[model samples]
Target: MRIGDYKVSYGADEAVFRTGTVRVWMIVLFLAMAVFPFWAGDYLLYMANLTGIAIVAAVGLNILTGAAGQISLGHAAFVGIGAYTSAILITKLGLPFIICLPLSGLSAALFGVIVGAPSMRMKGLYLCIATLAAQVIFEYLFKNWESLTGGIRGINVPAPTIFGFEFNNEFRFYFITVPVVIIVVTAARNLFRTRVGRAFIAIRDRDFSAQLMGINLFRYKLYAFALSSFLAGVAGCLWVNFIKIVTPEHFPLHESIRYLAMIIVGGLGSVLGSIFGAIFMTIIPEVLKSMLNIVSAFSPDAMAYLSPLQTVVFGLLIVVFLVFEPHGLAEMWRRVKDYFRLWPFEH
Candidate 1:
């Protein structure tokens, strides 16, 4: 039977993979991911790539809203900014994907700082409305700025390449998406162990007390926004290139809400939760569609009524999770692990 937990050093306590079993499982997980695209079909690989992108974006949102307690309703607009920036860099300046990727993130981070400036004076719903305003403004710019953003026409992106090795297919793109997801998740996991990340948590818990402890709330809040937007930008760059298009319609207000839902359904302030939530949110809808198709095989008229129920079912699932388990899927997963770890014993 497993006994108690122990750590002799601070480093050991703070380690990401604290036990051998966890490390082995992580290794197995990585191996599976590495082998996934090789055996998966084209559609499955596309979904995998999309899931990786969602994980990156959800983690970013979780960092800001969940960890830092900074609410945002303009996240999708920032994503659009990143997508457009990468597209413009590649199409107008003839920059390569490698150069445009970081540049896209930097551009979004700049705007994120500008949008986040009001956080020095605002909080709660007031701040949310401000972000909503930003969303409207950016959307307007995307639609009306013909000379720059293509004015509703959108930009078509070419596949990314490294040293002339073009990632022109879903199989090749899978390599890029998976590695980026891993790097982003690892960085986010490590971030919470740092001083700045602690500062974010402090701000989230109690800004007044955080200030009493000499933490500059504004600086750290801005840092949270910058980092969050940077990751979103990276996701956007990958998304634009993967889809081979950039459009204003892709990043809407509902899209921001969807990202918010991801963190909430996954678990607030948890890195692993972000992954769970992203996968859940991204895959569940597709699963529902498949189920609907199965039902339709028996009843030709089923889709007419069932089509609208898909949204209702999704909303109901979120409600059920919220009402029964407020801590989210991540908490449920933790409970499962704890139960298995202490098998034949109950605390």
Candidate 2:
């Protein structure tokens, strides 16, 4: 009775996985993911954890910059705030990891609201500069506040323990990272189906029109910041606990730029794009290093010639994506799926 993938209801039309084939593939993907940690080596697991954390942060940036059209250059500051909050709570107040996790997000959300206040009056590059100022301020605080942040020596964190089990290794922590990524992706994907998420898109498209439609531009803008920073904070907390350390040097301005690039290269405003972007950004460097090692095995001085080009190559790739496929990796992926789905057809 249901033929040719046509939907009879809005719910069906708005479904994240629109077809049975897509749902089956998603199940298969999750099953493969569940099996990955069991077979993956330590280094691969470590990279997986890093990619997971990056996914969380990139998704957040996409929510603000991609979906909401608000640019920020201080996302790294919010991330640092969360890292410090979790570190202080654990080392000083003796809070458990379970308790500190949400607290880290809340703490960052507070600062996000404060920093996002300028978005009410500022737009585009002006707003970007305002966020940049925040980055400088927070970085100064993180560095100079020796009493709290340990003056660049940083703080060490113990592995997270839950229910008498310690997530003390890459293998154990993979479980934690995977679940959080799943929840974050699911929530973000569903978010755009709601009124507030629509409002964000509206504001991103045309704020004056959105305002005329009774949407409070300022309030929604702050909401975007708060939500974005909250996710970044969660990523930060996971980052500190996973690495067993927190430092001022970790969340630098360049780190913020890297995140912006993730959303851009992954396809702005797309949840699946965020994941692809994070994975590509985090893993491609390692892949390049591996290739360099292979070349170095053949020629001892290969690194001397190839090392500097890694960055150039990476930048060039981004440029290519921007010029050829401004929609990012997600669009490329969708096209591939479409090609297969319509194989042997002549239109």
Candidate 3:
């Protein structure tokens, strides 16, 4: 979209930041992320932490369902696995935060492989049903396994500490979550450019054709699942540490659907779209609540109906976006940029 930008090499053509404007924007973005927590109030910081965690999970989900075209209803279970794994490592084994985080991801990845084994034989709805089964099984274990998960009572998680520096509050935790988010998002963006990434997309488009091209369907599908679950686990770890608790109720079916909605509302098969979808879904509920509170000033009854109304608006948004904008917010964003890139001129 750069009017005067010229690419002189093949590498330049494939570059992410194709122009000086994009590089400048990237720097400004990093600077903004660094500064936001410092000036934000407590409520804002809490919301920021939630949004950051959600973003990580959403992006991870995108790698599986969006890029790989796999269907899953067990994503929340994977997050739970990560949360519990990190909790156990911290409380039982007395591990440090640095060691626990990556191990949590590894644990989720292992579980992801187990859940994905069904994919070797089933696909589409059948595969989804299999994941649903996995979800139920995970829930059962979380609730009944008294020794590990603490049964129905749930486990109280301690805040993450690195080298004795505790992430005790929202602002301090911001340092942990935000930087991890940036690294994860960047890694995911780069993944799509590599052979493994392209293989996932190929299998997503048509596994038979991908297999014809000598791609191993089982291995790559497992890879997709593991990578996606790893990201989910990281997000789960962040959530457990932030809220300082681990519970079976924390990761639910609706949470899986919510992450699916994120990819659907953002844009399938797009990394930037994943982020856009995450921010959109995370912000909408708050916006609805804020509006309802304003209306409650004149009508006290509005307070009683606020929660349901928010749900209604949320559903309406998904339906509207699907019917009217199937390409999701990412497409809309691109159109806006395209229009402005040319400014008052038509080519």
Candidate 4:
């Protein structure tokens, strides 16, 4: 296949597993995951759970911001909605966890469509503001809506069960999360190869041009919002299950920023990047916290200030990456692999 001025070989064009090496790496990854629960400690399993949740959320945001070119600053609101919905459904309505999770996703999708209706008349910063407004409204409702949300006190969530088998331990939850993560990531990757996904990309690149080419910008924009919200809602449901609670404080503005950072740091439109971003962001703080603990042991004054220092460091890292490697860690990996493949051909 030829695109523009470049020629793509049959292997290059058709290949997701482009080489034998990649296939082997994938096999290794599967094997590692299969055995992870046996070897990994409780903390590591917890971290993996966090990574899975983040990856799910990041991929959803990527669908909105990267593929659809729609800026959203309130994705966490959808997550909150999903969590609370699931909690209420299970606790109040006596719905099973299995039914509640999907219901939560559907509820979020409905809200997403409502939010996306205005997207036809808005773009860029305006759309961002609209989403931001939604986020604030959701937070206010969660806090003040005492009858349903339980006000600022929040609500407790029960452990998830599948056919009478309870997933209460981190190890059991890890198994649940890993499979869900893989399924979501695979679905997201394949989404871009379909007509709906292509429409999103076309509209994202140039809405006027897409409309001229027979794509309905308004319909597709709404679709993007629905899909993104669905994914966020699923992530939220999983998150509440992991934490065993649904609190207004869990879905804050900072979480929205973290999701944005994950997509940006991972790679805007790449599925692999979303996973990388989630894992990196989730683990980095724990690593830093451990280092801080060691420092605190030696200096109590430094210990007292470690929290602010960690925040500063995290902020600095984000800034540096944005400035120097805007394409993100995924792009960086691509460059290194390309360099190796094209070795001795100094361009």
Overall lDDT per candidate, in order of appearance: 0.90, 0.92, 0.90, 0.87
Mind giving the per-residue lDDT tens digits that candidate 3 earns over 183-254?
999999999999989999999999999999999999999999999999999988888889998888888888
**Cα miss at 156, model 2 (Å)?**
0.5
Candidate with top TM-score is: 3
**Local lDDT at 317 for model 4:** 68
Would you estimate the TM-scores of all the predictions? 0.97, 0.96, 0.98, 0.93
Model 4, which residues run further than 4 Å from truth? 1-15, 343-347
The candidate, 1 or 4, that scores higher on lDDT is 1
Report the C-alpha lDDT of model 4 over 116-186, residue by residue, as the tens digit: 89998999899999999988899899889999999888888889998999999899999889988889998
Per-residue lDDT for 316-343 in model 1, tens only? 8778878887778899999999899988
Question: Root-mean-square deviation of each candidate, in angstroms?
Answer: 1.4, 1.7, 1.1, 3.3
Question: How far out, in Å, is residue 205 in model 1?
Answer: 0.6
Compared with the true structure, what per-residue lDDT tens digits does model 2 show for residues 143-235? 999999987999999999877799999999999999999999999999998998999999999999999999999999999999999999999
Task: Compare candidates 3 and 4 on lDDT and give the better one.
Answer: 3
Deviation from native of the Cα of residue 154 in model 2, angstroms: 0.4
lDDT of the structure predicted as candidate 4:
0.87
Candidate 3, residue 272: lDDT: 87
